[model samples]
Target: MTAWIILPVSLSTFSITGIWIVYAMAVMNHHVCPVENWVYNDSCSDDTAKHGYPKSCCTLNDVPLISKCGTYPPESCLFSLIGNLGAFMVVLICVLRYSQVLEQSHRSWVNTTALIAGCTNAAGLIIVGNFQVDYAKSLHYIGAGVAFPAGLLFVCLQCVLTYHIAATTLDLWMAHVRVTLSALALISLVFSGIFFIHDSFLLQHLAAVCEWIFVIDILIFYGTFAYEFGGISRDTIVTAIQHASSRACKSPGSSSTSTHLHCNPEGITMI
Candidate 1:
């Protein structure tokens, strides 16, 4: 059985799930989108009539996933930033320790992509949150504009890594699949970039679609972690092959007699 990947995986999962929960909370709370239409003042001008809105909406995003469904948007500063920050801390710790997982496989890409996305998302939020600008085109909006795409790119990178793990049929083909799937993310990102640069709605749509895809990607990646950490009984053919290869290399008269390795639980060994 492989060493436990439980701690880090669990922590990261909880962190992400918390954010999701917050989004759900925001959506259901006021029953109307908090930002569909509004005036320059912190008030919505004839909001319901103007936007044909039902008059209320909000989300927990806890920050990021706020219901696009309108303007006194319910903000969950508590969960949005503080909770996610705490979660990010846990995830960062795990990534630091487990970053080198799958030394012989493509796990490094997953780890790197995750680190980039999570760190950038959290950091970007921190900066935006502190800007004291809550209006449209405010510093927060600009920050989000920058951070969102970076996060998406890293997320696409994550999807690639996840696909690699999922399609790993005892060969390197999995990595190729990962790369291929990630290309879509890349394309979406590029289009989003072009749209944003030109200030087009096409970018917005692409981002929305990609956000859902990224979420799905996260879930798939979660399954990989679950197998790696929670379900110790499962073993990938790749890991087995690597193990066999290692044993073969360690045979008497081989050149590796001077080297020894111990299973380190904290180390997320991909191979």
Candidate 2:
């Protein structure tokens, strides 16, 4: 029932579901243009036809032939809204839970840095979602730049923390799994970046796919927190219940109190 368990589960379920919903809405709405229709030209309107590239999601200032997947009416708004909210919730939970995790561990400065990086990544995600690429290209790109790199940094930091804790307190297998996920995320992110930068249409498509992979990997990694938090929460509840029961049993003049402590140590009459 603690927020630690609730938040991680919420984040994992909402983010994965939300993004796919947005993608489905966009595609079903026919907002995406075919890859064969993409082109580069002086005018945004003319690029799709002249560039001789496959039809894809239209960028800002694209010609009439290109589909504006991210800018079309309710779908666009829905995508941004879901993305912004999801990012905010996930990051907030992570930040709050991170302190507890650190407290359980060695509480090193590196973990603190990871928390900061996670916050930065969250901020970047908010910015990216709010500022659609078509609406504000420069701002969108800036947000994306901040988000991707910071996200990678956060992942790396978490992986290191997991390894450190596993060596001492946590399960070694869990630590190994986290490290493996982080590595996969890192690799996917790198390829996504490269494909996004390349001029080829096919490369751009590959970049999009890689980006999805990167996101999925990160989400899965975050989902693992549910297991961690669940264990902690169970222990906390058990401890609290035991402590409360002990207090109740030790209370003066309680009918159910154990005979072992019936006599008061202070020799004072009970009210």
Regions more than 4 Å wrong, model 1: 1-4, 7-16, 30-53, 56-75, 78-83, 86-94, 97-118, 128-168, 171-177, 191-207, 215-271
Query: How much lDDT does candidate 2 score?
Result: 0.65
Cα lDDT of model 2 by residue, 143-232, tens digit: 778877887888788777776766444467788888898999999989988877876656666667678788878877777777567545
Quantify all predictions' global Cα lDDT against the true fold.
0.45, 0.65
- Name the 10 consecutive residues with the lowest summed lDDT in model 1: 58-67
Query: Residue 197 CA error for candidate 2 (Å)?
Result: 1.4
Write down the TM-score for model 1.
Answer: 0.47
lDDT of 2 at 142: 89
Q: What's the TM-score of every candidate structure? A: 0.47, 0.71
Instruction: Estimate, for each residue in 1-271, the C-alpha lDDT of model 1 and write its tens digit.
Output: 3445655455556645754655455445543232322211223445532333444421221122232321233444534453346435535433432333343353464665566666666565554444433344376566566555655655456555545555346324544544555565566545545543532333444444455455444333333443434333323434434544555656776553343453232233453
